[model samples]
Target: MPLNNIPADRSYTDEHEWIMISPGQTSVPTSPVRVGITSVAAAALGELVFLDLPEVGSEIEAGRTCGEVESTKTVSDLYPPVSGEVTSLNQAAIDDPSLVTQDPYGSGWLFEVQPTQLGTLLTAQEYAEKNGA
Candidate 1:
């Protein structure tokens, strides 16, 4: 699937996750970043039916499986693009999984974390090229 709408402001992972460091937060190590699966992943997963996200205050490792997303096609593990404590979850998306595919970058965001460190990440252009999107 063509991902023509990858946002330029955030960094992407090879696993198809995206992380957006909070705006106005210059220090990434302490900033709370928003995390979610990319449109490419959402499309590949087909229609989502269930979402299990990490609880707030839970410590998560970058690139590690933190939760799961179940779709009609398959059940996929959800990975955080950066490591830290989960600050919050998007309850709206949890309640309505379609929001994840409908608006992956907006209301579909999965969770937020105060990052302790970052993992390998690519710019939007790099991600597009890597995925052939």
Candidate 2:
């Protein structure tokens, strides 16, 4: 289920990832933006133990497995909500995977990308409903 606190400020993917738009940017973005797993995903994963992040300069597609997140309960693939070239990987999250469970939306961001596929993303409301929040 989606959390009400999942900010209405940006779009979310059905795969449970959230896309945070960079400041000063609006719709149909082509510049780098923050990306992270949602709280609902963090909770389901259960006690994150490791996170494999895509390298900068890597090309990723929306809905395609880009990396992985390992939790005490399971290991799960991480998907980008929109397709783009990865511009940066969060060294902080890689260094301390537990940060993902502690703060999935903020300091736990997975990557930055200059998105090329924003058209497929869902609004916050749509994500919430689709997830049965």
Candidate achieving the largest TM-score: 1
Q: For model 1, what is the alpha-carbon lDDT of residue 121?
A: 81
Tens digits of lDDT, candidate 1, 9-101? 788889999888532334556567789999999999989999999999999998889999999999999878788999999999999999999
- Top lDDT hit: 1
For model 2 the local lDDT of residue 17 reads 90
Which residue pairs show backbone clashes in model 1?
none
Where is model 2 poorest over a 10-residue stretch in terms of lDDT? 21-30
Query: Positional deviation of 30 in candidate 2, in angstroms?
Result: 3.4
lDDT of 2 by residue, 47-108 (tens): 98888888899999989999999999999998887788999988988999888888988898
Worst lDDT run of 10 residues, candidate 1, spans 21-30
At residue 125, candidate 1 shows an lDDT of 79
